[model samples]
Target: WDGVSPDRNFTGIENYTQLFTRPELFRVFFVSFYYLAASAVQIVIALYFATVLSFDLRLRNLFKGILFFPYLINGVAIGFVFLYFFQDGGTLDSILSWFGVGGDHAWLGDPESANTSLAGVSVWRFTGLNFVLFLGAIQSIPGELYEAAQLDGASRWQQFRHIIAPSIKPVVSLSVILAISGSLAVFEIPYIMTGGATDTSTFVIQTVKLAFQFNKTGLASACAVVLLLIILLVTWIQRRIVPDDKVDLV
Candidate 1:
């Protein structure tokens, strides 16, 4: 379905102004950052694994496939998986209870734990696919670069520092941009799992609520336009920092 379920009145940029009036805008921005930060860290971890795995090894392809498993599944399905994990008397709480520090906790229902739980699930489901992307990028570089670095008495860390990292900077930049934008647009996982209630409602999730639940289609459209602009602005900043020369687009 289109993100815009019902074409409503177009209010031009006024929808953008309403976003700041909400008291929870700061919290909204903070929760969104949680998603972005977690995703970025996950991508870093994935890149590390990808770099290590690029070397010849047994079942390398299988390992790559397995790593990317989470992304292939639907986002809503992934959300449900996490939903079950955090439910009262769920697997995670049970395990924690065994460790003696567990209290009766409602993961999604609690304000403090709720946003973090959603962000963590998002990272877990997504990072591997970026790993696969980075893997291909890391492997595509000519071996001569590494050879030359080694010939210059460069260490593995050094080679990665200058040769490997610079070569893959473009991929890293792209991944970061995707992470940030995706974090802002997040809806399915949060909405399905938490229903975006009790302060877990992100901007995009709130937009959905506005349209489908509240029938404020115009406001929802406004939220979407604001989100789009936010994404565009963030992307522009990233591109400015990384620049075209850093990334090997060709």
Candidate 2:
């Protein structure tokens, strides 16, 4: 369907063929790489904070809430909020100005920085959920294990390596799968913020534009199918790499 015609035509594999042939397809996937990198950073940040807060700390609960607050907000709202924050002479600019950095830089307008800036927003918003996951997994470890490790004069790093790391292996694997899938399907933030401008269009955003904006429903459907296949492939590879095994936290 051309999205406007009453007649339905069969174009078996033509849509998929065109999809694969398009140069824009490469660009869109390349855009996804930025978010993929950001997701890795986000997971690390979350794990760090989760590990720190899992231990005794001043105002730990407060810090947890603060970190998780961004995840609680609606994605569209977060996108809009960051729009002004990234605009010239905006909140971010003012903050940078305090550090002797010029405020004239276009964080979202420049092609070079737009994707990175949007990826940063994604990292900030999603890190909290990963944090909660890591924190819970860490806290579930038996306190006696930490006590035993301490008795042997095990350093903090050693304890994490031998105990905390093994205990949270399942959660870590889950987070990685989620991050990779999320990175590939990223849409809301870039869509709402840049409307896919400045070379920031992601695969999902492109599919959406094809379906609604361009009235190419068939092509859009093909794109969606390809995305699903890509996600499944990635998930399968992840499961193979991190097979489910009983982790002894003791």
Candidate 3:
């Protein structure tokens, strides 16, 4: 049924079929890959920072607040801020100009680089949350373990590999699940920044457009359901592969 029509039509599986058959479906999922890659980088950066800051560091709390501040900002506000940032001759361009790079390039207008630019924003905003998670997990490890490892003349890397990593396996697993799910459901950033234009349309943004912009409520609902099932399947597969066994930190 069209979104505006009150007449209810029962078209069983038709919406699903249409959704799956569209050529745009492949592109939509492909766009999600950029964010997925960004999420991986975000995790690594977060973990690195978390590990470093968990130990003694100068003004660590201030640094943590600076990193996490982006996550706390309103999405709309961040979107507008980045719009200015990526616009030609904008802040990013000015900074790059210092290194002999030209400021004439359009960061968000080029289809080739649009998704990458948007994904970078995602990494900037979400890394803080992941950092906090890793930091907490690392801090919770028994201090005695580190002391024992140091007594054995274990290097920093050895202490991390043997103690920190094993103790934080659960948080790492959780971060992976969240990253995958969040990557698939990315909406607000691309929606507000690019309006899903320039090949930056994500699955969630496409669904919103189908429902509201195209008046394809039935199809949009099907897309939403499919997204949910996809997320559930991914979570199930991840759980099966990474069993939730208790990590013995001995």
Better of 1 and 3 by lDDT: 3
Error of 3 at 192 (Å): 1.1
Candidate 2 per-residue lDDT, tens place, 1-250, comes to 7788999999999998898787876568888889999999999999999988999999999999999999999999999999999988999999998999974778888776999999999999999999999999999999999999999999989988999888899899999999999999999999998999999999999989999998999999999999999999999999998897778654
User: Which residue ranges in model 2 land beyond 4 Å of their true spot?
Assistant: none
lDDT of each: 0.80, 0.92, 0.91
lDDT of 2 at 165: 89
What candidate 3 gets wrong by more than 4 Å, as runs, is none
TM of each candidate vs. truth: 0.87, 0.97, 0.97
Q: With candidate 3 superimposed using the best TM-score fit, by how many Å does residue 142's alpha carbon deviate from the native?
A: 0.8
Which prediction has more favorable TM-score, 1 or 2? 2
User: Ten-residue segment with the worst summed lDDT in candidate 1?
Assistant: 1-10
- Which 10 successive residues of model 2 have the least lDDT summed? 241-250
lDDT string for model 1 (140-213, tens) is 88888888878999987897788778888888888888898888878899888888776888888777777787
Best by lDDT: 2
For model 3 the TM-score comes to 0.97
